[model samples]
Target: MAKAYWVATYRSVTDPDKLAAYAKLSGPAINAAGGRILARGLPSQVYELGLEQRTVLIEFDSVEQARAAHDSSAYQEALALLEGGAERDIRIIEGI
Candidate 1:
């Protein structure tokens, strides 16, 4: 089966404390769920209607695994902490 990826793009961060909490909790949750963080950073350059937001990319063995990770208790807890902390768009995509 093709691999899958979890992509999250942050539009804005409104609460630094909550963001920090999420960062701490999400790492372990992702790792325990067999997900690997591929990238996390600000865009170096932008073109067209480029957005000024942070981006995160995570790779999983399969789409099911990616979905599982998001639904896991640990990740759910992290999501609770991140709620309202930042405006983000997250999605799971199948790899080519």
Candidate 2:
């Protein structure tokens, strides 16, 4: 099976404190669920309609694993901490 990738792009961060709180929990939660963080940071350059915002890329063995990681209770808890703190778009894609 093809590998999967979790791509998260932040649109805007309204509350730094809340985001920070979520970050503290999310990393461990995701790591425990077999997700490996590949990259995370603001873009060095933006083109087209892209905004220079925080982005994260995580790799999982499969799409199912990626989905499981997102749906896990631990991750759900972290999600709660992120609610309203920022706007983000997250996608799970099959890797080549």
Candidate 3:
């Protein structure tokens, strides 16, 4: 089965308190959907200029599985906690 890789980048955070809550909620949501958090944050070089405060890398069994994890009701419940929590950009790509 082909795995799916997800790279989540955060643009801005207006609410850290809410993000903490969302993180906790999402943890279980992702686990339940058969997803593994490969990495959450790793120090990255800043050659030019970029906001590299937060980044998440996750993997799933397949692209469909990744989509299912993100689109599930459990994750939706988790996302609800982030209504005004933080701003984010997420991308899921089929990997080798």
Best by lDDT: 2
**lDDT score, candidate 3:** 0.87
Better of 1 and 3 by lDDT: 1
Model 1, span 4-24: residue lDDT tens: 999999999999899999999
Record all residue pairs in model 1 with backbone atoms less than 3 Å apart, i.e. clashing: none
Order the candidate numbers by TM-score, best to worst.
Answer: 1, 2, 3
Candidate 2 Cα misplacement greater than 4 A, ranges? none
| Candidate 1, residue 29: lDDT | 99
lDDT of 3 at 93: 96
Tell me the spans in candidate 3 whose CA falls farther than 4 Å from its real position. Answer: 47-50
Q: Give the Å error, residue 49, model 3.
A: 5.7
Each prediction's total of clashing residue pairs, residues at least 3 apart in sequence or on different chains, is 0, 0, 0
Residue lDDT tens for model 2, 1-96? 999999999999999999999999999999999999999999988899988889999999999999999999999999999999999999999999
Q: Which 10 residues in a row give candidate 2 its minimum summed lDDT? A: 44-53
- Provide the TM-score for each candidate, comma-separated: 0.96, 0.96, 0.90
**lDDT-sorted candidate list, best first:** 2, 1, 3
